[model samples]
Target: MFLRAKVRKKDGKEHRYFSVVENRRIGPKQQKRMAQRTVLYLGEINDGQEAAWRKSLEVFDESCQRYSTLSLFPEDREIPAEASSSIQVKLSEMELRRPRMFGNCWLGCELWRQLGLQAFWEEKLSSQVQRETVPWEKVLRLLVVNRLIEPGSEFRLHRQWFDPTAMAELLETDFAVAEKDRLYRCLDRILEHKQALFVHLRQRWQDLFAAPFDVLLYDLTSTYIEGEGEQIPQARYGYSRDQRFDCKQVVIALVITPEGFPLAYEVMDGNTSDKTT
Candidate 1:
């Protein structure tokens, strides 16, 4: 199925027309021939007419279980109401299911590409030759995208968020990429490449935005854990930024350029002083 365009000369001027067309293979296989059938004649559409058509477009909101008109143009743009394409849907026969988030996940993937994290991780965390069920880099991408989009724990992403969102479709993999153990394993593997990952991101920022690193800003913050944190060596009693002094915490320090590009970060013992850091 495609759009077919035709041109005709009238009054010494070429006029253009468009129609929805479908290509069909006609006759037997031994004498096969291609034929185009016009499904709908669109005639000549002007800008105003097109805007009107777009203004009349509707989309189904599965979450709300309702339909709303879609706007192709910005909210400030005025659409002409002189023409419209109306569609009739039978409410009784219609069913809506499997509502997956798409826009934010797509944007997350695009940002990941723009930062060159895909290739960087692919090289850093190369897939093993043991016939891995899913690429380690892709799994890492899923984790990063989950953080960027919803900012949830790996457990939540694996149990609740993965199936409901479009990450599976966007990442081109099945539920294996979001498996609970795989997420944790991917994190464990990337710890060794932390410094290299920071360098790669810094270079990407410089290349993409010409970001300057001359003026570096440093800051430290502490995040307290709810439990005793006995198993974690770094977790200790510290100055609580969140006013949770009773709980064990870890101090996180970060260095960034003036333009807000992160240069480096460190996770120190909770008892470490800011001045010492």
Candidate 2:
């Protein structure tokens, strides 16, 4: 049992009220409190009047739960008409895919063939010896055919072979860690055949651009080489085109048509003067 009492002054008079709470549960079933409040004001406060006011309040609460249109409404309302959307959002179904390289399928194939890709691989590249070799096809496709891509990007595209499923799907080959070392060795073979490699590439460029060539523009530029230095004569330091004067540079001479179709290219000593040629 519990008791609560309150004293309040109205207009200049004081009045007192009391309430009691009785615990109704006797066993482990459950327990709850029943409460009733009494007051001394006979003029306004009575049991019947308070019961009527409470019933009205209860009806207002039910109406707000049932028929209220606007979210904020008067005290008499019951229900709210507005409800939020309960639709579940769907995820995108797109699969992981490679980027598109060329649009016209036949034209792309013709252009690749005109680049002497097949002959360069089977004839010239096959004729050379490698200290350790991987699929020569893979290396040639990367360095020779896809030479348009930067060297840093080559490793990214090449690493697709590191996944067994991706390797089987793309190349129809089961790749392993052992194959990666062989791939590196085959790429090294490209340096040994650089002269012939560039010569063949220059020939292909000439054939592709010969019909369209009129005015040719030539410029000399240099790129900084990374890692251990090679004994190549052309890899030296002078005026660094890439602004890497602190490091030895690889000088390249690029020849292009007025329209910007590349025709020929040559590498020479970085210290060589462009004005002399």
Q: Which has the greatest TM-score? A: 1
- Writing each residue's lDDT as its tens digit, candidate 2 over 85-146 gives 22222223336466443423334334556787656655656655353244565454533333
- Per-model CA lDDT versus the true structure: 0.81, 0.52
| Window of ten residues with lowest summed lDDT in model 2 | 67-76
TM-score of 2: 0.46
The Cα error of candidate 1 at residue 130, in Å, is 3.5
- Compare the candidates by lDDT and give the number of the best one: 1
Candidate 1: tens digits of C-alpha lDDT, residues 1-277: 3555688999999887876556779999899999987755889987676555444444556889997644322244444464365334443355769999999989999998889888888887775615688988889888888898889889999999999889888889899999999888887788889999898988898899989887899999888998888888999998999998899999999999888888889999999998897
Candidate 2 wrong stretches, greater than 4 Å: 1-111, 128-134, 144-184, 187-210, 226-233
